[model samples]
Target: MYKLICIDLDGTLLDTRQRVSTKNREAIRKALDQGIEVAIVSGRPNCFTIRIMNQISGRMGHITFNGAYYRIANKTRQFPIPKEAVMKVAKLAQKYHVRTYFKNKNLSLCTKSDPGILDYDQFKSQTPLKDQMDMLYNVDVVDVLSNQDINILKIFAWDENLENVRKMREELKEIEGINLYLYDENFEMSSEDTSKGKAIQNVCADLGIQLDEVVCIGDNYNDLSMFEVAGLSVAMENAPRKIKEMVDKVTLTNDESGVAYAIENFVLKENE
Candidate 1:
C-alpha cells in the first residue's frame, strides 16, 4: 500500500480556472482519514502554495521551488542557488529583456522594469488567489544587485514572444551551477541538481517511508523527477501526450477532477 501521495498543483490538482475542485478536496480528505499522507509539491513559492493548502482541510506537506525548499510539520530546509549563479542569471535575463520574478526565503520580488511586463498589482490580482494572496509584495521594484546578499530560492523567467523565451533558455543552459525546468514559453531556475525526486526522498527518509511506498502525480516536465522516484507515477489526462506516455497510469483531466479520480481509483480502491 502507498503511504504517501505527492501532488502537483498547476495542471494536476487545480483546473483551468486555477481553483481546487470540491471533488479533489474531498478525495484528499478521504486519503488523510485513511492515514495516508498527502503533499503539495509544486514549482510555485511558499506563499502561493500555503494559501492553496489552507483551502484543503487536514495536514499536508509542502515541497516548493521545484524541491529547493520544503517544510514538513515544523521542520524546514532550503537549498538556495549560488549567489554568483543568481547574479549571472539576473544579468542575462536583463540583457534578454525577459521578465523575471525572484523569490527569497521570506517573500518574492519583481525587478527589471519593462513595458512588456504587467503592472505588479495587476499581475498579482490575476493569479489564482487574487488579492487574498500575498502576490509579490515583499521587495517590490527593488534592484537585483541590492539584494545580492539574500539567499535566492527560485527565479522564473519568461517573455511574451515564445522565440525570445526559447532563446533565453538556450543561453541559460550554458551557465553552470543551476537546474532549469523548461516549459513551452517559460522556465524555472534553481540550484544545481535540485528536483522533487530528491526532496521526496528526503521527506520519505524523515518519515521512515520508503520511496516505493509513495505515489506521485503531475502534468508537467518538472514533475518528471518525482515520477522517477515514486513507486507508482500518474499523469493527468490534460498533461501533454509526451508526459502521459512516460507515466505508469493516466487519470482524468483537471477539469474532470483528475486528482480525485486518481485517488478514488488508484489510491482509495486499491487500499480497500
Candidate 2:
C-alpha cells in the first residue's frame, strides 16, 4: 500500500563501490510502472545526484544538500538558511581555525588548505572548483562573507580529528535554530527544519499521499529521521548497529543488491 518510496544513495541504494546494481535498477523500473513515486534523497549536490540518476532508465526527483534543495523533473527549489545563523556558524568556524565550505544559490566556495587535506585529483574529477579562490587567499575571505544576500544552505568543516569533530557537533547544538551532525570526521550544519524527513514530507504532500504510505531505506545517522517517519523502514546489511536497530527489516548488503531485493520482494509483490 506504499505510495511513495524515499531512498538514500551512498550507503543504501548504491553498492560499496558507489554504483547502482542492475537488479536494483530493474526493480525500480518495475515499481515506477506500478505508480509508486521514488525519490533519491542524499547529502550530495545535484551535480553528483544527476549522474547517478542517468544510470537508471527512468526519471526521478532528488532531495539534495541534506534537504537544503529539492529538485524535481527539471526545476529546483532552494530553501535559505537564516542570515544570522550563517554568520554565527561562520564566526565559530573561524574561531576554531576550521576550514569551511559555503554553498550559495549558484556556487560552492572553499579554502585551498593543505593538499593533504583532500584528494585534489579525485575531487576535481567530481566537482568543478577551478578558478575559484581558496578560502585562505590573500585578504581575509571573511570580508567576502555576507550571510545577508547569500542563500546559504549548509556549511561543512573537514577535519581529521574525531574528538574535535564531536566537540564541534556539541557546540553547534547551542545554535538556536540549526541542526548539526557528524559524518565520518566532518561536521554538517543545516537549518533545524531541513532534513531528509522534511524533504520526504514535502514530496509526499505534492503527490497527495500520507507519510505512512511511504518506505525509506538508508544506512547512516543522517537517515534516522526519515526512518522515524516511514511506515516501512529498511536498513542495509552493512549499516551500523544503531541504524539497523531503527528499522523494521534489514535487507541484503548493498554489495549484494539489497535495494533490488527489497523492492522486488516487498513493493513489487504487493502490486502483483
Q: How many backbone clashes does candidate 1 have?
A: 0
Model 2: per-residue Cα lDDT over 45-142, one tens digit each: 66666667667844667788888888664456667677777777766666666666766434455532544442223333444352122223221335
Best by TM-score: 2
lDDT per residue as tens, model 1, 1-272: 88999999999999999999999999999998998989999977766677788789638778988888888755678889887777777776666667777776454555444453423334343334422323352233335455557788888876676776777888888888888778788888899857899999888888889998899999988899999999999999989999999999999999999999999999999888
Clashing pairs in 1: none
Clashing pairs in 2: 111-135
Q: What is the TM-score (0 to 1) of candidate 1?
A: 0.83
Worst 10 contiguous positions by lDDT, candidate 2: 130-139
Q: Evaluate model 2: give its lDDT.
A: 0.73
